[model samples]
Target: MIPQSHPKLHRSEFTLGVLAGGSGIRAGRRDKGLMIAKGRTLLERTLERYGKGFEEVVTCCRDNAWFYSRFSSRVLCDVEPGQGPLQGLSALLAATQTQYLAVIPCDQYSLPLDWFERLSSALSSTVIGVFATDGGTHTPCCVLHRDVHSQVNALLKQGKRSLMALYECEGLAHMAVPGAGMDIDHTDALHGVIRKPPQ
Candidate 1:
């Protein structure tokens, strides 16, 4: 449960953003989110695993908005398709309406149930955002203040599309979340992994 001090953070104030706009060059050019793993699409698994608690969900993808719309509250297509996850992040940030946005990649199927709560708890006057890190930073699995949209746009304008650059610019905080960074980036990884049964 969220601490009482952060009473303003209700489910309505959060929007879950799924980053599904990758070029999938590592996944044999196939849409990684749509790839079937153990009879469910990666997108479905992602939503089921970490999409709880948010009242709204927005998905960013390169194409097939129609299909994504079936599972998302709203679907956004990248303005410049095939760019990268940073472009997807910009699009998601632009479309978010809540005070907080929780982002997770569509291929990240191993996130913890308390992922959003932990990240949200870390946000304060000084920390505008918080990303999960085990040993390495998982930039996508983060919670950001809606105000960070301007910073994201600034990075885009400066031709800096790396998520790390954005995190550094904002001095984002990090929380250790073991297994939160596991993602399926290749066809072989998908076949070797299995989504756990819903709790």
Candidate 2:
């Protein structure tokens, strides 16, 4: 169930992370981060949304040293392979110096503007974190406490890779947001989101 509205929390205590590690199987193996829309890459667009709103902004990628050269700093490479978002989450969690992390997909550009504030306020000792979106509890849009890092590592060691699996951990909560399913997964999906270039 989605948690009730709570007071805003300090942004300095949480790290904002973007999971851009997709192999792009649905999008023809292209790096979704680099996909262009509205004269900007998806990663660029995502950063514009939450980059300045947190203590730090980091990107979790896979074997993409080129991405580092392209973006410079704040880009973290996945230590393990073939683990999907699990690997990205591990990388993000490890790189985060803050007590909490808020992760959103590179393709999920239309999230509520107040997402971080809402999720941050919902966290507490008993509630490790609250993931936004009631449509799917396992969607990449979620927040987590640094305390769960060990559990995530344990799951990784067990060869378990998938955000849905991570969500099953105890003490996590969910937040429902209206109009939450605007992620762009395929090429055609872009037409509905991206605007045409100036005439």
Candidate 3:
């Protein structure tokens, strides 16, 4: 069933929270968001997914927001330094005016355009949160009800940065995303996004 058909929720009211808060330490403090593989910045590539996937597209970055001007006002960086992604989730959640929000990482550039269709089909009103999976729960890729306040807030108050803990929400479900599960750890991240590897 579509979220629009839910008795309490509507698709138009949902928000897409694109979490891009990391310092890109994995890529040697090189500003992973600005990293270019195929002439497109990682931030720009990631935005393309949500720009087409959801009604609201927001990027949570550090300080430099001008590079993302094409996305302009919709782009937001961390207000309090070193607060971590879980901490930033609250701020992004507050920025939206909806009951349903999908939290996806900027590292996933391989996400399919039809990804949301699978998410909507796996979700209904009762589920509190759901993750996009290829075979198991894609820890970094998840969707949740805005009411995640109580649990997420409590974790934030305690200063636990791990988002996997947030999956403890009531009735967590999983939705398969196929080729969309790729993560940009090294240079190989780009290989999966546009090419089909040999058998």
Candidate 4:
């Protein structure tokens, strides 16, 4: 249950964006979102786990837009190709039509079940965004108020493509969740093995 101290945000005000724009050099150039994990595509697992209660779900990808479109309400391509997740994030931010946007990488399948809830609950009128962290910050797994769009655009204009830069610029709060934020960056991770974060 959500604490009463925070404003009760309805799911209708939120849109979920799955980041899938990586070049996938670690996954043999395949679309990481489409890779199989525990008998389901990473994309499928993501939607099944976090798709409920969002106003809509969209995917940002550099390729396979048609395949991603089949699973999401809309599919977006990165605004600048090969620039990395920051470009994809910029596109997602521009495309979001809801008051709030929540993002998760398609390859991170073991995120906390309450991931969205935890992030959303942490958001107040003053707190523009919240992201998950175990020890290191998971910048992509975040919920942002629509008002942050201008900030993101400014960062992009300055060629600040790093997510951590955006995190610090926005003063985003962190929600610590153990055993969360690990992503399948290698081919071996597809076979049900959990990758340990760097110590």
Candidate 5:
């Protein structure tokens, strides 16, 4: 977009992949992304955030395949099935050609728009993923260079899937992003943390 077309959207070279699928044991099986938050559904607010970032936003929501149709391009189904967020990330890498890939959890109450730029500027190469950390624990919510696809594919090929394992690579950079690492795992847990996102 020419920025003027959508002044609220931020333009970036990275493709923002939002991971929104998985049985919602936390949200009581009511499709966590679609669960009413504040007033707007989490899904709606998430698409808007990413829509402003990359040229496109691809959502990996298995249950809500059509949920993103309301938005423009940038949303697509994950090519692989039954795999967790790691698999979803792997699938995302497989479909993208951008030099950088960002994986986001759609359940967050709010995320900073400058997130991709901050993480990208910190890491020098695609060999590592820039993760959000606190204390010293690596938060799986992160962004990585496109170069990890080969390693990620191999892991999925072996029937092994987990977001944390992808960071075991030699040059992975796990840095903390202040409060960006917090996630809304359950409604009660989300209670006073995130703002009422726009619908």
Candidate 6:
């Protein structure tokens, strides 16, 4: 259960969701979210990191329903499995009761807890989404308006998987968060991250 100390924001505002549906091709087919690090599963660590900042928390995954359900009853699956993040986003957009969603991948453990607030403060009527960037490239980490559901669903049906492609098609804005980089896409990468001393 979500702690009572966390403030509840209206669904018309924003909610947090984690995307954990990657194929794990580089991680020897293991579910990255379930990978133990510092004695906690990645999914649990993600929720503990971001859960208090939002009224609700959800996870989007292609499988392991029972595993994710331990953190949130709102666990959802992609509209079509094996497609990519775009498919997972479609399911999240459809399921979200909030006006906006701030997304972070399950593998992104170092994303600051203030992420949603930082991106949200940058929102305006003209912008439908705000993507967090590191250096010059935009990471999958982003915040999106709920109204884009239909457009996202349409693109998923058309077989679009690249997020940068969708961002260009939608004309979304970007926000740079220094030191924010995605590092764990494979087994070696995950090992490199966990073994490193916390700064």
**Residue ranges of candidate 3 with Cα displaced over 4 Å:** 1-11, 135-137, 196-199
lDDT, candidate 6, residue 36? 78
| lDDT tens digits, residue span 84-186, model 1 | 6678877888898887888888888666777777778878777888888767755578888888888888887898877678768755778888667788778
| Highest TM-score model number | 1
Q: Rate the local accuracy (lDDT) of all candidates.
A: 0.80, 0.73, 0.66, 0.79, 0.64, 0.73
Off by over 4 Å in 6: 1-12, 191-199
Error of 1 at 159 (Å): 0.8
Window of ten residues with lowest summed lDDT in model 3: 190-199
User: Which has the greatest lDDT?
Assistant: 1
Q: Candidate 4, residues 54-164: lDDT per residue as tens digits?
A: 878889998988999999899998766778777877788888998889888888766767778777888986788887887784658889887778877888789888877
Better of 1 and 3 by TM-score: 1
Candidate 5 lDDT tens digits, 1-199: 5332212222476777777766677667656777765687766666656346577666767676777555534556755556776777776777676766777777665556666656666665333667766556555567776777787888777777765676676667776665565566678865644454323
The residue-by-residue lDDT of candidate 2 on 64-172, one tens digit each, is 6576446534888766655688778888888888878888887776666777777767787688867776465347677888887887888989988876677778887
Per-candidate clashes, comma-separated: 0, 0, 0, 0, 2, 0
- Candidate 2: segments with Cα more than 4 A from true spot: 1-7, 63-73, 195-199
| Candidate numbers sorted by lDDT from highest down | 1, 4, 2, 6, 3, 5
Off by over 4 Å in 1: 1-5, 191-199
Ranking by TM-score: 1, 4, 2, 6, 3, 5
Clashing pairs in 4: none
| Deviation in Å, model 2, residue 148 alpha carbon | 1.1
Encode model 6's per-residue lDDT on 34-87: one tens digit a residue: 987778887776666655657767789877988888877489876566888788
